[model samples]
Target: MTQARITIDRDFTVAEVPRRLFGSFVEHMGRCVYSGIYEPGHPEADARGLRQDVLKLVREMGPTVVRYPGGNFVSGYNWEDGVGPVEDRPVRIDGAWHTIETNAFGLHEFVEWSKEAEVEVMEAINLGTRGVDEARALVEYANHPGGTYWSDLRRKNGAATGTQQDPFGIKLWCLGNELDGPWQIGHKTADEYGRLAQESAKAMKLVDDSIELVAVGSSSRQMPTFGTWEHTVLSHTYEEVDYISMHAYYQEHDGDAASFLAEGVDMDAFIDGVIATIDAVKAAGKHSNQVNISFDEWNVWYQRGLDGEDQPHNVAKAGWREAPRVIEDTYSVTDAVVVGSLLHSLLRHGDRVTIANQAQLVNVIAPIRSEAGGPAWRQASFWPFARMSALAKGQIMQLAVDSGKTPTAKFGDVDAVDATATWDEQTGRLALFLANRSMEEGAEVSVDLRGLSASGVRSAEVLTIPEGGDRNSANVLDAQDTVGLKTLQEVGIEDGVLHVKLPALSWSVLELDVERA
Candidate 1:
C-alpha cells in the first residue's frame, strides 16, 4: 500500500462552476415515475399525486433541473398520448423496458410536481417516433403565455386556471434522447440525426427563443461512434443547439474491485473528448456561439445481471405491476469512491459542461429506492451525491496534486488521488472534495489555500465505512443507514497549507472559511 499526497495552491483560479451542473434526471421507467415519486394513494402524496417524501428527498438533493420522461422509453413515446384528461389518457406499450404505460401521470402532472419539488423541468422531445411538429407543440404548450393554440389547450387542461400563469415558461428542452445507438427505437445515422436535430431545434427556437436545446451525442465512450458521433452531429447543429447531450454508465462486469475504482478515468476522458469535439465544431464553422455538453445520463448500473435471472420478454408484461426491483444495485463503499471521482471530474470541466443528471433519480438504477406502499432507502451512491449537491457551489479552483497511477480492467492505469475544489462567494467558503482510489492504503493530503487566505480550517468531513467494501444493508422498511460525513473538525494552518488525512478507498469533503488577506 502506497500513500499519496495532494497540494492545492490559492493562486490558481478556473471557471465558475454553474449551480445547474448539479442537476439530476427522473424517468417514467420502473418505479421512478410511479410509486417512486407519484404514488397517489400513499399517505404522503399531495393533491396532484406526487409523493411528499420523494419531494422532500429531491429538495434535499437540491437538483437545479430534472430531465423528465424516458431514457430509451422516450424514443417510442408520443407526447399527445400523455396530455389531456386522465380518463382519456391512452395506455400504450412501452417498448424500451417491455412495460405498459398507464399515461395517468403525464406532462401536466410532471410540471405541477416540478413546482412542488422547487426544481426546473428539463423536457426531452420524442424524436424516435415523433418529430419537429410534436416537439414544437410541446414547447408552445409549456412556454407560450396565452392566445395561442397550445397555450389555450393548456388552459383547457387546467394548467392556466389561476391568475393567468404563463403556461409555457420551460427554459430547457432536449432535441431527442439516445438516437445514435442501435438499441434506440428510431436510431439514426450521424447525418440523419444532425439534419433532424437542426430542423427540430430551428423550429423549437422559433417557437420559443428563450429555451435552450441539447442535441444527442454518443451514448458512451465505448460506443463505436463515440468521438465521430459528436463531431458530425455538432457540425450540422453547431449554430442551432445550445448543448450536446452525452450518456455513460459504469459497471463492474468482471467483479474486480480495482477495475471499478479506475472507471473515473474513462469519465474524464469522455468529457475531454467531447470538449475537443465541441471546439472542433466551432473552429470548422467559424461560429462565435459556443456550444456546451450535457451529461444528462450517467451512474453505476449492471447489478441486475448478478442479482437475479434476466426475465424473458413474454413475462415482462406481467411483471409490470410487480416491477421486481430491476437493476436495484446495492452500492458498496467502492462505488461511492468512484462516484466521488466522477463528481470531481464534472466540477473540473464545469466551464464546458453545463447540465448533468444521474440517470434515473429513483428505483431503477438510481440513488433513491422504494417499494410500493412501503418506505424508501438511500443507496450508497446517494450520500456522496447529496453531499456534493449541498456543499458544491460557486467558482471552480484548479488543484495540483501529486499522485501515482494504477491499471484496471475498464479504464487502464489511472491516477490514485482524484479531486476538485469549489469556492462559494456568498458564504466566503471553499469546499474541496477528494477521492483516494487506492484499494490498500490511505493518502496524507496537504492543501494550500490559493488566492484567498483563511485564518483556520473550518471543517473536515469524511464519508467512509469501517469495512472498505461494505455496502448499505438496507431494505424497504428498514432504517436507511450508511457511512456519511462523520466528522467536521477545525485544523491548524501550517505555513499557509492545511494538512488533512484521507482514508484509503474513501471520499472526503473539506470546507474552509475564506477571507481576503
Candidate 2:
C-alpha cells in the first residue's frame, strides 16, 4: 500500500462551501430534454409530463442550481418559441444540435420543473443568433413584476403560479454557451464574443440589475485560443459580468487509464490558468470586483465515439431527429473516482470557482440515468457527488496532502492520494473526500485534524470496482445496483488522527462528528 498524510486546519480555510458549487446542467440535447426529463406517455411521468422517477432521483442527487436550455442549443434558441401553450409553441430546427425542437417545454415549463426538483435555475441567453435586445427582453419576461409588456406576457403565459417570487427570482445567468468554439452556433472570434457579452450583460442588467451574468470563456482548456480568449473576454467584460464560464469534457483516449485517472491534475492546472488570466486582467485594469468562475459545463464524455471522426462538427450532421441519443457515456468506477478528484479540485479552489454545474444532469453523461417509461437508476459517478453535496457543508478547510507520486503521460507526476475536507461548525461535523488514483495499490492515509476531535464516524462509503473486476467494470441498465457504492470498513481515529485505507482507484467520503478541542 502507498502511504499518504493529510493535515487540515480550521483557520486555514479556502472559503465557505458555496452551495452553487453543487449545481448541475440540463441541455436541450439528445434525450436530455424530451425523453429524459419530460415524457408524457411514460408510466412514471407526473401530470406535467415530467418523469417523476427522474425528478425523484435528481432531488436525491441534491443539485442546488441547474443551468438550463442549452449547451450548444441555447445559441440558436429563440426565447419566444418556448412560451405560452404547448400546442401554440413553434417547432424549430435546433441548429446547434441539428435536431427538431418541439418547443413543448420552454422557459415556463423549465421553471415549473425546477420548482418540482427544488433547484435554482441558471438561465443562459442566446447570443449566437440573437443579442442584447433579446437578452434584455428575456430578463424582463422572466423577472419584471408587472404592467410591462414582457412581465404581463409572462403572467398571460401561466408562469404566475410558482413560489410568488417576482420575475421567478432567477439570479444567475450565462451570457452564452461556448461562443469561442468553432462548432458553436454563430461562433465568434474572441474580440467578437467579448464585445457582444459585454453589451448583452450591460443591457440585461439594465432590465434587472439584481442578476449575475457569466461571460463565456474557452470551451475547453485544450482549445488553441484558451488563454487569449479568456484574457480578451475578461478584459472587455470584466466590469459588466460577475463570473466567467468554462466548459471541459474528458475521456480516456488510446487506453490511457493511468493518465485519465490523474485528469484532476489537469483540471487544477486549467483552473489556475483561468484564474491567472482573470487576475492579470484585473491588475491591468485596476478593478476591485472579483470575476469568479462558473464552470457551467464539466464531465467525462466519450467524444470520439459520440462524434465519429469529425467530432466537433458532427452535431450539424446528426439530422433533424427530436431528442436523438448523443454522448451518453456510461460511466465506470474509474470515471467515478476521477469525478471525485475533480470535485476535490473544485473544493480546493472554492474561493474563486464558486459555481460549477456537472453538464447534462439526467441522461447525457450524468450521475443519474433514466429510461423512458422504465426505471431510473444511479450511475457509478452519482454516489460521490450525492454524498459530497449532502455532507460537505460550512467552510472548505485548507487541506495539504503529502503522498508518493505517480507518473502519467498527460499530467506528469501527481499524488497517489488526492483529498479535501470541509468543517461544518454548526452541525459539529467534518467531512473528508478522498480519491486514490493508484491502479494497483491501496493507499494508507493518515489525516491530521488540527484542533478538532473526531467523536465518531457518521458515514463512510467507497466506490470501487468489485474483486475480480477491473476499471472497465460499470453499472449498466440491468446491473445498475451491482456496481454502486459500498461501505468502507477500514476506518478509525486515534489521538486526533484519522486513519483510512483507500482502495486502489476508488472514491471515498468519510463524514465524522467533530468537536473543537
Candidate 3:
C-alpha cells in the first residue's frame, strides 16, 4: 500500500468558507423541471407541486444558493413567459434540451420553492436574443414594490400576497449563459457579449442598485478563445459587473479512468488560469472594485454518450415532448470520488471563486435524484457534499501534502492522495475531506495535527466500492445501496495524528472538535 501525510494548521488559512460555494443549479431542461422538481400528482409532492422528498434531500444537502431557469435554456428564454397565471403561461419548445417546456414553473414558483428549501435564488436573464431593456424589466418585475408596470404584473402574478412576497429581492443575477459557445441559441463574439452584458448590468442596477451581477466568462477552459475571451469580456464589463462566470463539466472518456480520477489537477489549473486572466484585466484597467469568479455551472456529466451529437447544444431535435429524460447520468463510486476532489479544489480557492453552483440540481446531473411518481434517493456523490455542507464552517485551511505521484495520460502525475480541511473557530469543528485516486492499491494516510488542541475523532465515514462491487456501481432507481456512505471503522486520532485507512478509489470525511489554536 502507498502512504501519504497531510499537515494542516489554523494559521495557514485560505479564506472564510463561502456558503454560496455549496450552491446548485436548477434549469428548465428535460425531466429536470416537469417531473424532476415539480410533479403535481406525485405522492411526495406538496401544495406547490414540488417534490417534498426531493426538498427534504435538498435541505439535507444544504445548498446555500441556487441559480435558476437556465443552462442554455436562459439564453433563449423569455422572463414574461413563466410568470402570471399558470393557465395563461406559454407552452414553448425548449430548444436547449430538445424538450417541451410548459411554463408551469417559473420565477414565482422557483422563489416559492427556494423558500421551502431555504436557499437563496441566483437569477439569470436572457441577454442572447433580448438585451438591456428586458434585463431591466426583469429586475423591476422581481424587485420593485407596487406602482410600477412590471411590479403590478408581478402583483397580478401572485407575488403581491402578504406572505412576504412583495419584493423577491434576488441579489445575485447572471447576465447571460455561455454566449461564447457557438452552440448557444444566440452566440456572440466576446466584444459583443461584453458590451451587451455591461449595458444590461447598468440598466438592471438602475432598477435595483443593491443587486450583484455576474458577467459571462468563457464557457470552459478548453474553449478555443479561453484566455482571450475573458480578457475581452472583462475589459468591457469589468466595472459594471461584480463577478465573472465560469462553467465546466468533467467526464471519463475512452476508458481513461486513471486520468479521470485526477480531474482535480486540471480543475486547479483552470481556476488559477482564470484568476490570472481576471487579475490581468484588473491591473490593466486599474479598477478599484474587485471582480471575483462565479463558477455557476459545474458537475460530472457524460456528454459524449448522450446522443450522436459531439457536444451539448441548444438546437431543436426531439420535435416537441414535455419532461423527456435528458442527460440523466447515474453517478458511480468513482464519479463521487472525483466530485469530492473537485469540491476540494473549489474550497482551496474560496477567496476568489466565491460562488459555485453544481450544474443542474435535480434529475439533470444532480446530487439528489427523483422520478415523476417514483421515490427520491441520494446519489453516490451526495454523501461528501452533504457532509461538507453540514460540517465545513469558518475558514478553509491550507493543506500540505507529502504523497506519491500517480501517472496519468491527461494531468501528468498528480498526487495520489488529495485532501482539504475547513476549521470553524466558533463551533470548534475541524472537518477534513479526502479522496484516494489510486486505482490499484489502498493507501495509508496520516494527518499531522500537532498545532491543534487535539480532540478525539468525532465521526469518520467513507464511500467506496462495496464488497463484491464494481467501481462503476451506482445507487440507481429502487436499488439504493450499491455504493453509499458507510462508517469507516479503521480511523483514529492517535497522539496528534489522524490515521485513516483509505481504500483505492474512495472518498472520506473526518469530523472532530478542536479549540482554536
Candidate 4:
C-alpha cells in the first residue's frame, strides 16, 4: 500500500471560492446545440424547445456561469442571424465547424435557456470576422433597458416580450475566442488582436460601462506565441478588460496512462506561468488593477481523433451537415480522475482563476451526455464536478500534503496523493478533494485537521474503475451505467485525524462538519 498524509490549517487559506469557477461552455458545434440542449421533438423538451432532461442534468451539475455561442463558431458568427422569429432565422454555412448552422437557437434563446438552467450568461463577442460596431451593438442589445436602436430592436424581436420586456443584463463578456491560434478564423498576431480587443472593449464599455470584458489570451500554453501573446495583449488591453481567456484540452496520447493521470501538474504549471506573465506585464505597465483569468474552454478532448478539429477538414469535399457529431470524446474512470485533479488545481489557484468553464458542456466532452430523442445520463466525469460544486464554499483552505512521488513521462514526479480543501465558516463545512494516482496499490491516507475538530463525516464518495471493470470502460449511449461514484463507507475521524483508504487511480471527495478551534 502507498501511504500519504495531509495537514490542513483552517487559518491558512487561499481565497474565497468564486462561484463562477464552477462554470460550463455551450458552443454551437456538433450536437451541443441542435440535439444536445435544444431538441424540439424530444419527449422531455419544453415548449421553448429547451430539453428539460438536459436542463435537469445541467442544473444538477451546478454550473454557475455558461459561456455561449462559440468555440470557433463565434469567430465567423453574425449575431444578427440568430435573432427574430425562428422561421425567419437564416440557415448559414458555419465555416468554423464545416456544418450548416440553422440559427434556431441564438442570443435570445440562450438567455432564456440560461434562466432555466439557473446560470449567468458569459457572452463572447466576434473580434475575428467582425469588429467594434458589432461588439457595441451586442452590448447595447443585451443590456440597455429602454428605447434605443438596438434595445428597441431587441424589444421588437419579442425577447421576453410581454408587459415588461427586460434586458438580459449579462455582465461577463469575452473579447474573442482563441484568435491567437492559427486555426482560429480571422487569426491575428498578438499586437493585432490586442489592438482590436482593446478598441472593441473600449466601445462596448462606452455602451454599457457596467459590463466586464475578457481579452483574448493564447489558445494554449503550448502555443508558439504563448508568453509574448499574453504580454502584448495585456500591454494593450490590460486596463480595459477585467480578465483574459485561456483554453486547453488534454488527452492520453499513445496510451500513456501514468502521464495522463498526472494532468493536474501540467494544469498547475500552466496557470502559474500565465499568472507570472500577467504580473510581468503589470509591473512593466505599472497597473494597479489586477487582470484575472477566465479559463473559458477546457476539458479532456481527444482532439487527434476522427471527430477532432485538428484533422484536415475540407468543407467542399464533405457536404455541410447540420449538427454533425464532432469532438464528442467519451470519458473513462482514468479521464474522470484527471478531471477531478484538474478541478483541484483550479480550486487551489482560486484567487487568480476566478472563472473556469468546462468546454462544450453538453455532448462534446461534457459531464452530462444526452442522446437525440433519448435520455440524459451522468458521465464518469460528472460526479466530481457535481460534488465539488456543491461542497466547495466560503474559502479554499490551503493544504500541506506530504506524499510520495509518482513518475510519469509527461509531468515528471508528481505527488502520488494530491489534495485540496475548502472551508465554509457559515455552513461549518470542510470539503476535501483528493486524488490517488498510484495505479497498482491502495493508499492509506490520513488527513491531519490539526487546529480543527470534525463533528462527523457528511459524505464520502470515490470514483474508480468498478470491480471487474477496466479503467478504459465508459458509459456510452447504450450502457450508461458502467462507471460512477461509489460510497466510501470506511471513513472516520479519530483524535483530530481523518483516516480513509483510497484505491489506486481514484478520485475521492469527503465533506465533514468542521469547526475551527
Question: Which candidate tops lDDT?
Answer: 4
lDDT tens digits by residue: candidate 4, 1-517: 8789999897799999999999999999878998899999889998888999999999999999999887789999999998887788889998887889899888888988998999999999888999999999999988998789999988888643221247889999999899988878999999999999999999999999999998988888899998899999999999999998888888889989899888888889999999999999899999999999999988898766554342325433567888876666789999999899999999999999999999978987888888888899889999889999999999898899888888899878888998999999898999999899989877888999867889899999999988899888788889898998899867988887999999988999999998877
Task: Show where candidate 1 strays beyond 4 Å.
Answer: 159-165, 303-324, 404-413, 467-479, 488-492
The Cα error of candidate 4 at residue 234, in Å, is 0.5
On residues 280-362, what C-alpha lDDT tens digit does candidate 1 reach at each position?
A: 88998899999998999988877444435433234364555433345656666777777878888888888888889887788
Which candidate model has the greater lDDT, 1 or 4?
A: 4
Q: What lDDT tens digits, residue by residue, belong to model 3 across residues 454-476?
A: 57788889999999998998998
Every candidate's lDDT: 0.78, 0.88, 0.88, 0.89
lDDT of 1 at 460: 77
Model 4 misplaced stretches (Cα beyond 4 Å): 159-164, 305-317
Error of 2 at 259 (Å): 0.6
lDDT of 1 at 250: 86
Clashes of each: 6, 1, 0, 0
Candidates by lDDT, descending order? 4, 2, 3, 1
Flag the better candidate by lDDT, 2 or 4: 4
> How many clashes show up in model 2?
1
Candidate 4 Cα lDDT to native = 0.89
Top candidate when judged by TM-score against the true structure: 4
Residue pairs with backbone overlap in model 1? 10-450, 10-451, 142-168, 143-168, 143-169, 144-168
Lowest lDDT 10-mer window, candidate 2?
158-167
